[model samples]
Target: MAGTELFGTIEMVDVFLAMAITIVIASFVSLYRGIEGPGIFNRIIAVNVIGTKTIVLLVLIGFIYERPDFFDIALLYAILNFIMTIAATRY
Candidate 1:
């Protein structure tokens, strides 16, 4: 498949930063939901969503900095998030 469009490195980094900022802003909604949800289940879901976004944000940071090490941090956060969610839901 021949792609008809090409993006410069600077443009690609700009797009990545924009996407990362958008995701962070969007996660603020989930943070608010987690804080003010009417039910515990709703709050749990919101917190989980925030955790998911955090992991994504970590990877995005790695990409923005041109450091692959962030992927490991993201994976660790994913594991912690999963465990915490399971413990929270089970309790």
Candidate 2:
């Protein structure tokens, strides 16, 4: 039973790591879009998307590391991201 539980945990870790990596790669693409966007609207949207993805990555990291405290940080980041996007759009 212990071996089975350990195997399950390891699989969970692998899945979370894979998801984190995928989000990271997506963030890079979003960054490129922000940098080379055709206009201001496109750039702003791309940047917002990057911020959103980063939050997801953070949550995934917390899960992989078995750190529930990191969830608070993720929630804080999410709120900040939302406020920043609104502020940027207004600016």
Candidate 3:
């Protein structure tokens, strides 16, 4: 039991680290797309997609840290992102 628990803890840490790295990379890509995109709509779509990805990444990080409350934040972010995307598209 002790060994299994230790291994699980290490795995969680590894997952968290990997997610953090991915978030950084995604942010960079989002920035690049926003700056180099051909037009305004493309940049807006890229940013919206980045927002969704960020929410998922946050949820995964919360799980890794053993905190369920973070899921609530992720849910709220998803809702807000959806609303904003729709608004942006309509305008």
Q: How far is 61's C-alpha from truth in model 2 (Å)?
A: 0.4
Put down candidate 3 lDDT per residue, 1-91, tens digits, no spaces: 1122335457546756687788879888888988899998989988897898889788877767778899999999999999999999899
lDDT of 1 by residue, 37-69 (tens): 898999989988999999999998888888899
TM-score to native of every candidate shown = 0.85, 0.84, 0.80
lDDT of 3 at 86: 92
Quality of model 3 by C-alpha lDDT: 0.81
Cα lDDT tens digits, model 2, 1-91, are 1122335457657767888999999899889989988989998899789988988888888888878888899899999989988999888
Stretches of candidate 2 exceeding 4 Å from the true structure: 1-10
- Reference-based lDDT, residue 59, model 3: 83
Q: RMSDs, each prediction?
A: 4.2, 3.1, 3.1
Query: Where in model 1 is the C-alpha error above 4 Å?
Result: 1-10
| Model 2 steric clash total | 0
* Candidate 3 worst ten-residue window by lDDT: 1-10
Put the candidates in lDDT order, highest first: 1, 2, 3
